[model samples]
Target: MITFFRSFFNSKIGVALSLIFVALIAVAFAASDVTGGASFGGVGSESVAQIGGEDIGTGEFSTTASNAFDQIRRQNPQLDMAAFDAQGGIDDVLEQMIGSYATATFAESIGLGASKRLVDSEIAGIQAFKGADGRFDETLFRNALAQQGLTEARVREDIRRGLLTDQLIIPATFGAKLSQQLALPYASLILEGREGQIAFVPSAAFAPKGNPTDAQLQKFFADNGARYRIPERRVLRFATFVTDRFRDQVKVSDAEIAALYKKRSAEFAATEKRDVEQLIVPTEAAAKAIAAKINGGASMAAAAKEAGLEPVDLGLQSRQDLAKSASVAVANAVFATAAGKVATPARSPLGWHVVRVDSVSSIAGRSLDQVRNVLENEIAQEKLRQTVSDFTADLEDRIADGASLADIAKDEKLELQVSPELLANGQAPGKPDFAPIGAYQAMLPIAFGLEEDSGPQLVEVQQGKEFAVFEVQEIKRAAPPPLASIRERVATDWALAQGLASARKLADGIAKSSRTPAALEKAVSGASVPLPGIEQIRTSRQTIMQQQGRVPPPVALLFSMAEGTTKVLEGPNRTGWFVVHLTKINRGDASKVPELMVATRQQLGQVTADEYGQQLMAAMKAEVKVQRNAAALQRVKDQLTGRNREN
Candidate 1:
């Protein structure tokens, strides 16, 4: 899980949109931590880390980790904070933070910098800060930063650091190319084929029939207690309010509608639009000659095709719209001509035009009476926008003034709704079938981020129509369940463990003696218990690489082993072990497939570039002299698991 984190960030959100070092896995600050609080450790623990003279505060480090964990959750929903900690997620997050700081420090040492305008452009480019118009909006930007519980200064500084690192990292790996000679061997190896036979020794085959004693079960439970620990669950309390409540307060007046219609009078008026197919000749004589050919019973399309020209279809355009692209004379000539008729040649800035009208459409004009419903709907929407904006602003002010969800609910006559304990993905730990509904789906991310003591926050769940004011009600820390609850499972695990130990010995003997295919068959037949028959696998290296990392242990081993050699392999999830026998090897010549050779060369070149990036990142870190605060780091881990919540 931790190893994947570095690759994910470096590839998806790296420097200059092209990060390549495993040692540096920074997501930077544009990836907002939707969870409001970053209290991973105590509210204010000792500094989390020190990179050179700069100290990384607990709050900043925790925020970055929180953002990263949220990203990982999108990929693997079953993973919880406890499992994340156990899988070294904390260490990965810290490493990425260190990598980012080190790169920026190294950049600054050599006078590299990020200008404020460049930083502003980066911030503007973030989709989170953009409004409905698809441009940066100060309101949306401020709201986003506020929702993430981020300060303006911090976001700007982090973005600045990201920019500085990008300047240094991109040039270091500018252009890398692998020579044909070096790439040929690797490309040919991709086509190499192998066939192998695999025999399984099931752990269940050598089973321990009886269950464990109570004393033994108790010891096993204690030994693996952490495995049974439940992740932290949180209860969300919220109440939704629709725009209908404020609808009664807003009314669209007839005079206001009239004024709006008057302002956009051209939109309400009738207009003609035509579909035109046109061919422009470089000279007036050429266009006139082509027009005469069409007039003399020759098809316009045939004439154009014969002259090595294709007519352009100007799809559905109004007279004014056509005039914008062509000349006013061209628009007048095209619109005046009937559909299916050729228009007179008209000169434009580009050339002489020969146009044919394909089709024409007209929308009848509507008076105030005809479009009253449409006018009312548009007017109401605009009025409702102002109402909701004021309404939410007041709700925010009330929250700032120390109003709780319950207080606001009673004051505004809103009903409060409470949710069962939920994980980050909005599923209850005990109820696998449970799913988040309605506005709760959107609110869950925001709800989980909020601190328990924080006041209610209004989230625009329906974009403009619906919103929910919510706060965290309860937080249950992850911990082990009672031993009595899982005794049967523990006993089963102990039996499997015992059986697997015996199976390993049997598998080892078979592997050591099976020097030939006949000997492997004899060893398998000589087993004490009935086992499954050996299965043959034949595949190329390219096929295995195509499926990525889904190869079976034995089949993967077939390619790595000597033609006659055999090796024992453990099955995934402790199902059993396998004895892999390599029977044949087929070598490939990649030179015959030029496409494959070129592709392999490009891929190998990227591999070389990646290595260069990794080395440069390592050197920068060594110079920066990164330092970790053991006590501070542990407090964060302990805090995530609720082991040191009080600290």
Candidate 2:
């Protein structure tokens, strides 16, 4: 059963079950508000879904969706509802809910259920509900449930369902095996090496004859206008309040610094550290004998060697470090021993230890003069943080009362900066010369999301350093510039496109004419244009796939072709093309590559198990009839999105 559990948990079905457990746990706590009094009006009376004659209520569906949303929000604290909706988060949540309901219905049909005792045991085992003593505390459990808005009954039911589902699925998908015959061919192919002749035909070698005419350049620009179009740009007016600006104004007196130092005197005190060595033996008698020999005119190393054990150095450790790594008793004994003196035998979990203190560093405290600069800087920063907080709060209140950013900036004697035409990526045309009022990267997303009528919003630029209140002054929608405006860019692109086409044509001709490596080499040697240097090298499949440097297109094509076949392969990034001829093919023996074979076998086994589990789920889904009320589901979705709040 333990082996079965291990194998099942390691499988894809195990991963799915783990995800389900997390989802169910999240739903258990978040469903209270959703199920309490919320209604979808006409849709509330309808079933959002039905599986195997069991109807899933609209309220339950809404609750599940709400739980999923809350779980996602907790996982990604920066994620807003708009971003979540754009990523199809709602649809994903609904699908998962539907799947869970279907699976639960199937479990019931198979007469799978969890006992009350089992459910209780599971609840008690959860660490969140446990006290400091590691025992389940009723008060802590109730508080945790209350915080998540979950009732005990609902949580217990979720646990019971999760247990039943696990019982039904885990045993069925456990211990899936892959035969050696199934894995051998794949392992062999991956290990195969090929030797080939590769010749490069760079795009620059086949430069387009003469410049492109105005009509051709214009046509090229028009054809790919969207590629050159700029995204929407915004100009913002903002007022920044930086903590560093107030740092100079803060005065830290000598008295204050002294008080601060005295208050945190312990931090300036150094811990007593010692260098100790030990000879650990299996018995206390051996430890005592070794310690006696070391104390009785014999060297510690010599005594350790005599006992047929090497001395272990516990270098320069403090009391806390010794307590953690060794036993507290050993630490106490070592700390109590004088320098150049051997300590008595100390019993530990490992065995018994004979310890000697080589040298001891006495505890030392720093003088006020030593830490004066650090204290002053800390005090100044603290004062600056407080001043900035107060200033920003006042500015926020004034803005809330309808004061414009410019008016506030003037009144406060703060610098009011206006951004140039800024793209969504925070870059202006030409070289990026503009810096944002605060943290530009953090502010850009929020700035673009703002509406024209939204007025000003306060944004934290740097956590403890700066903040800004900014308003969009103007917006420019994305549009393509005229060909005349970007004639140079268009001409450059046109030339590259024509050059790539010419290179491809030349490569194709070379491939078509030459049937053997010797013939291809002869054609390249006699070609009028300057071509890439030819390098004939033996490369492997793994090297081609995983090498950091660019593997020429012909190198990849070599493995796919029979020996003595010539092929033209396209170059990466339209740099040019490669004409490759496969000269030799080498097959690898799978038995020699044990490491790769083992990895391939494990991969194939996992893949096969995952496929088997997917097939099982599909079959089970087919056996159970499912009905979805699209209208009701959409209504629930609308409610979640805050589109309509019909009761």
Candidate 3:
């Protein structure tokens, strides 16, 4: 079983699972904590990491770490960082903190600075910062940043770095070549078709006659004993401490609500709306021609029809909702036009527009009835915060008063859970789920730290909108399942081992005797190889490069062999070795040729981009002549918050 687990760890699914876990456990938590209200550990005050001469600050590192942390936490809630580092937990965060700073500085030195306009545009595009109708709202933007523990300048910088990184990579990887290949398939496969046939002497088809003696079994067992052991796992009990539960405690009085309404009266006030219809003409000359016919007492609809224009109706729309390019001009003209009247001509980014105001409405602020819903939400959030605060305080008081964790949660209406027994190295249960890395990290120490009969310990947990308090109840230890449970599996393994040796012997005989598919097939009658489709086997070196484990080397060797070449490929038992013959040549049909061409071009582009970036960095490093003051960088990182780590 341990051997199975280790082999699994080296498989494709294992690598993918590891990466996915890393992303969830590492990225999300870093993002949250650094951007949240957590204090910076004075990390970025001085330069912790350097690329060339750029001195990144502590504040920047903290912000970057926070963003990265949050991203990681969200993705992998139960990451076993012990497997990565003995220090585990926050040390992973520290590495990301340093790396992010280095990456950011490197980007800046390479002339990949993000512009203010880019940041502003990104902010405007965020739906959370938009008004009810989707127009960017300054108040909403500020409020959202505040919630994330970010200042406007910090958020802007975060957006800037993100954009810069994106810009830097776009041309490097997915430029013209990638785009063309993705858009067309024939452009990818550069080889013409070829003819060939393949036959495999399958290991499964050659069943051995009898079981080996005890000596043979002992030898094999001794040889592969390490493969059968399992990786270590960990057991944990913890208390979570999140502040969202106290949100209800912050109340909004009627007076405060009224005051807030008065202060933001402009926001609440409705703008005059118009039911408008418009026709756009590509040029001022076109607009004039259309306007002329309408001005000469011709119906605007008739003029629009003659000009092959499509009139778009606003249908009770506000000026705030229009695109910036046309909003100002269109709003002015539409407002100025009398109802049932057409505007002469207006110019916008796309072209000139002729507008007709169908109907106008009174100012559109919220009615008394509609304002209640917003007020209720505001009040409820305040109350939720207060409730959470009260709960935390009460739980602390109870613990101080010698009350158990179960008691506190019971009083607070929280849940108590017992996680599946885990091993010291995180090998228990199935694969790790990284959706709650922070919570799991927090839980682990408590579980390990507690003594038997310690009673309940209070821990914080999150469930979407609701917060939770978990009380660890009981724990079970690790012990192997009974032999009876897996006896059939063991017997099957014994049979397969015997079968594999027989299959390999058969294949070796075929490899020495045959040079054609027919001869090979005749040598191993009733073989289970997928040789029928082998005639279509055309592959490239790069395609072979993309493959991993048991198949890659064989494919590469096969590609190297000339037509009519014969050889034997050895593999592990129960997975019989192959006796192969290059019976036909289909350089075009083979997977290696085209895959290699595409891969070569991509590698070339990467080399170019990397060289360009290095050259720029080298120049900048020389010109700046940076004076080292690591302390200053740390102070800066300490002050900063809400930055992306990947930058």
> Where does model 1 exceed 4 Å of error?
1-85, 92-185, 226-232, 244-327, 331-367, 478-489, 589-629, 639-642
**TM-score leader:** 1
TM-score ranking, high to low? 1, 2, 3
Q: lDDT per residue, candidate 1, 1-647, as tens digits?
A: 01111232242233312222221222224323323334544546456778878777776666666666666655665466667777677676777677678888999999999899987887787776778999989998888667666677777777777777777766776688899889999999999999888999998877689878889888877888786777667888888989988888889888988988888789889998898888999998999888888878888789899889988888898889878998999999998989877889998999999988878899899897887888889999888999999989999999999998899999999889888878777888667788788877878777666666877778888888889998888977666767777777777777876788788999999988888888989999998777789897889998999989998778888988999888988886456799999988999999999999999988888777767767777888899998889888877677665566544
TM-score of 2: 0.59
Q: List the residue pairs that clash in candidate 2.
A: none
- How many steric clashes does model 3 contain? 103
Give the Å error, residue 204, model 2. Answer: 6.6
> By lDDT, is 1 or 3 better?
1
lDDT of all predictions: 0.77, 0.73, 0.53
TM-score, predicted candidate 1 vs. hidden true structure: 0.74
Candidate 3 on 1-647: residue-level lDDT in tens?
Answer: 00000011233234433343334222121222333333345342355445455434444445544444334434453432222222232333443333333445556766777677766777687666779988999898777766666666655554554455455444443443333344233323344332333445555555455665556655655555443433333434333445655554566677767766777677678778778777888898988887778768878778888888767876876676544537687777777777777776888887898877778887868854468669767766767766766666776677767887666656655555545556433334544563435565445545544444565555555533433344445544222333344344444566666667776776777777777777766665644443222332555544554565445345545665777887777655456566656666544432345555566467655555555544443443445443445554434333332122213
TM-score pick, better of 1 and 2: 1
